[model samples]
Target: MPVKVRGGLYNPYDGHIDPYSVTQALAAGARHYGAVLRPHTEVTGLRLREDGRWTVTLGHGAQLTARRLVNAAGGN
Candidate 1:
């Protein structure tokens, strides 16, 4: 069988990222701003409150509210 090609795209500014290093730097920056890093915490649910705050439900039935949320769930 034969195929026909239409067009292609290219960019000279393309780059790759080291996710681990980037995450470490970001975590350090966030910690400098009083952000608490909880390791091994499982989030069960999340909801947006009427006051524009986020409600995060944990696996242990504990709920936390914050104005901003960052989902940095990594892969295995």
Candidate 2:
């Protein structure tokens, strides 16, 4: 058997950065923008408020309010 391809291999720019460094930088930037990062918190429910904001219900009956929510769950 034989395999055929129209285009050959294309290698883009190669780079590497420490994962911890990236995470730290993102945390710092978020803090600079007045964003709060809550680790170890589990989201139990989510609902839209009357003012179009989001009411996030966390574990232990804790709640959070945000005008916008970003679900960065999966990798790019």
Q: How well does each candidate superpose onto the true structure, as a TM-score? A: 0.66, 0.69
The local distance difference test score of each candidate is: 0.83, 0.77
Kindly list the per-residue Cα lDDT of model 2 for residues 49-70, writing each as its tens digit. 9999999998899899998876
What is the Cα-based lDDT of residue 3 in candidate 1?
44
- Indicate which candidate wins on lDDT: 1
Model 1 lowest lDDT segment of ten:
1-10
Q: What is the C-alpha lDDT profile of model 1 across 26-75, one tens digit per residue?
A: 89999999887887899999999999999999999999998888886755
